[model samples]
Target chain A: MIEVEGVERRYDGVAVLSEVTLSLPKGGLTAIIGPNGAGKSTLLSVMGRLQKPDAGRVTLEGMHLAQAPGRAVAKKLAMLRQDNHTAARLTVRDLVAFGRYPHCRGNPGPEDQAQIDRALAILGLEPLADRFLDQLSGGQRQRAHIAMVLAQDTGCILLDEPLNNLDISHAVRIITLVREAAQALGKTVVVVLHDINMAAAHCDRIVVMKGGRILRHGTPAELMQADFLSAVYETPISVHELAGRLVAVY
Target chain B: MSPEIRARQITHRMALLALLALLAAAAFLLLNARGSWDFLLPFRGRKLAALAVVAVAIALSTVVFQTVTQNRILTPAIMGFDALYVLIQTGLVFGLGAGRVSALDARLVFGLELGAMVVFALLLFRWMFGPAARNLHLLMLVGIVLGTLFRSIAGFLQRIIDPDSFTVLQDRLFASFNAVDPGLLTLSALIVAGLALILWRLVPELDVLALGREAAVGLGVPQERLVLGLLVIVTLLVALSTALVGPVTFLGLLVANLAYLLLPTGRHAVLLPAAALIALITLIGGQALLERVLHYDTALAVVVEFAGGLVFILLVIRGVAR
Candidate 1:
């Protein structure tokens, strides 16, 4: 489990995240749905240990992220930020192989290679494995980044805005990959998503935030009411049952 | 390409560069040694070694620096090494007059320059990288500001100095292989080799670091500490090379970019040496060509700077910095 308590982060004395307390269970896909500047990414970043909080502490799988050794924490959890840019021309396989750096330290054994191969296979990245990242389309590059995290093979994975430039098909493929990783591999996956329908349709739980505070955290069925979402977004939203799943429209 | 094939290709390219560097070194030695074999051999050999050291230092520093900053256009040159030298030289001449400054022992002048550069690099970078870890663009801006400030101060000093003294000072300013201080050269080799020892361990981390700060940190590379270490190493190497020889300005830029273009990969293990070899080839080969065929009296720095400046502008025009 990942637990965050009283986490507060400020930029230039302005609170970007405030008094945020949340927990992610051991397994399953948890989508963080929120408006822009809702502090959802900030909360996730703190939980993943990407950005340190001004107050409070975060622990992953009972180990405090701040105090844990970097290698140890890396073995347990993986975090991917929104903007991953590089001028280095790296092949897909080369990029994915870096996931094992914490474990192998650049000298990969048979098992590390196996993990890399599995990551590539899981993401359907085999065909494009030899291609350079810059040569690939944005959706492909997004998947390649996702493949790298999956190759880390950690217990908990945090991804912010993984669907930024992905098309519907690739996005669905990625969600399915995340869901499968959570269900089959028993990994705790926390994804910050902007789309409510995708979160409702796929995630086991959705955490809603507004103005740097967590407003709601529940299963899709529990938070599927129109009034609840409308209140959270400060706009009129309607919820309807589509294909036995709650879909939100505004 | 797959890792194995790409790895093989990189090896082949490195071997090619190494062979070319060797050939150039041999040609430079043999062609330059026409009369008084004993006297010329050691003399030319020392000069050759000095050139090789400067080339390697500049090339590796440039590549490592570009990777850290994630900006291809930025180099250690931009960090004010040459400008700092000019400012110091001009200041010394302005205050003490040309005769007094020129009368100072060559060893004393070299020591002063080296000490000033080391202090300058340490002070400037210690504050530049903040706890929050400022972005690459901000760092570039700071370097440019410092360089411009140094240039302006040097300009002010040069304007007031007499013409005869100014000409003498200009000779000291331009990079000339004929005038390398043996004492400084030995000191530089030791310092650069020490930096290289530390960098050997950092090669793997640097490969990952080239992916940028967020990924490096996320993957457990300890971005802050690694970047600080790299900055220090780059600073020392740049200072050492600049003190040993007058600044080669774009030589590092030219060699590093060529290495990248020749071998397109993220592996620094291959990239560093490849860049070093390219630097060697450019320096030794160009030096030999100018000395033998063209019988050029101009400093090698002139040709290097001209070529490097052109490459810099091409990179900018191509928008490769992004």
Candidate 2:
């Protein structure tokens, strides 16, 4: 479980997240949905200990994030940010292999290699594994990055805007992969998504944020209400049940 | 092209290039070797050793500096290390006349210069790493300002100094591989070797770090501590080279970029040695040409600066400045 209490983040004297307190349960897919400047990425970064909160604390599985050794936290949690610019020329396989760094510290044994292979297979990246990341398509590169994060084998995985450069098909495929990883492997998955319909269709829980504050949090069936989303997004959003699944129409 | 085939080609080319560099360096050493076998061997041997040491220092420092800064065109020189070194040399002569400066122990002067460089680096990094003004351009601006300050101070001191003293200082400032100090060569070699060993141990981390700060941190690298340590290493390397044969700013830039182009792999393990070899070849080969073909008419620095500046401009045109 990841717990954030009284978390606040300010940039240039303007508050991005103010007194935001939330507890994310273990072993499920939680999609954070928000409009622009909603602090969704900031919250995820704080939870992953990538950014420090100004006035609060975060605890991951009874270990305080601020106090825990970075290696220890990294072994239990992995984060993938939106922008992944690397100066080094790394192949997909090499990038995925770096996920085992916290575990093997660059000296990978057979088990680590096996995990890397499994991640590649899961992402359907076996063919592209040896290809350089820059040589691959944007969607393929996104999948490779996801594979790397998955190869970390952390119980808690946080992805910020993982679908940014992905097409609809690749986006759905990634959403499915996240859902399956959470359900089958019993891992906690928190992803910041921009598409409301995808969040409604795939997420177990929906977290709605507007202007850096959580407006509503509930199962998709409850949080996908027209009025709730409309208020949160500051636009007209109609939620309808189609094919036994809640879909949002803007 | 298939990645496997590409990798093989790159590796093969890198190997060929490295071998060629070694041969070139060897030929330079042999051609320059003169006088009796005993006297010529050790005398040229010392110069050869100094050239190799300074080459490795400049190459390693430039590569690592580019890695941390995430900019291929930027070298340790941009951080004002070479300027600071000049300032120190000038200050030494200005404060304590040429006689006293020459009387000072060589090792002590080298230590003082190195210490000042490290402290300057630490302070610059600490300021840049702060939350406010986290921009790379801001750091670059600060570095440029600091370099200008050092240069102005040295110039002011030069203006007030005696003409004879100025001549001595000018000789010190001019980078000449032919006149390397044999007395300080042994100590510099040991220091450079020790630094290389420590850097070799950090090869894996350095590889990860080349992925940029956020990515490396997300991958669980101790970013702050590792960055500080790497900066110190960079400072030491730059200082050693600068103290040994004054500042050869563009040589490092040229060698490191050439290494990257030749190796075709971002892996530091290959990149480091490739840069070192390129440096060795350039220094030795350039010196040999200056002595043999050019008939020692012009300084090696002029050729290096010209070639390196052209490469730097080309890199910028290619949009690798970022």
Cand. 2 TM to true fold: 0.94
TM-score, chain B, each candidate: 0.91, 0.91
- Alpha carbon lDDT of residue B153, candidate 2? 94
True contacts kept of 1: 0.69
Q: Highest DockQ: give the candidate number.
A: 1
lDDT, each prediction:
0.85, 0.86
TM-score of chain A of each: 0.97, 0.98
**i-RMSD of model 2 (Å, 1 decimal):** 1.9
Off by over 4 Å in 2: B1-7, B131-133, B306-322
Docking quality tier of model 1: medium
Residues A1-250 of candidate 2 have per-residue lDDT tens digits of 9998999999988999988888889899999989999999999999888888999999999999878887788899999988887777788988999899889888899999999999999889999887878888888888888998999999999999899888888788889989998999899999999988888888899888878788778898888789878888789989888999888899
Candidate 2 pairs with clashing backbones: none
Instruction: Compute fnat per model.
Output: 0.69, 0.67
In order of appearance, the predictions have TM-scores of 0.94, 0.94
Task: Write down the C-alpha DockQ for each prediction.
Answer: 0.68, 0.65
lDDT of 2 at B47: 75
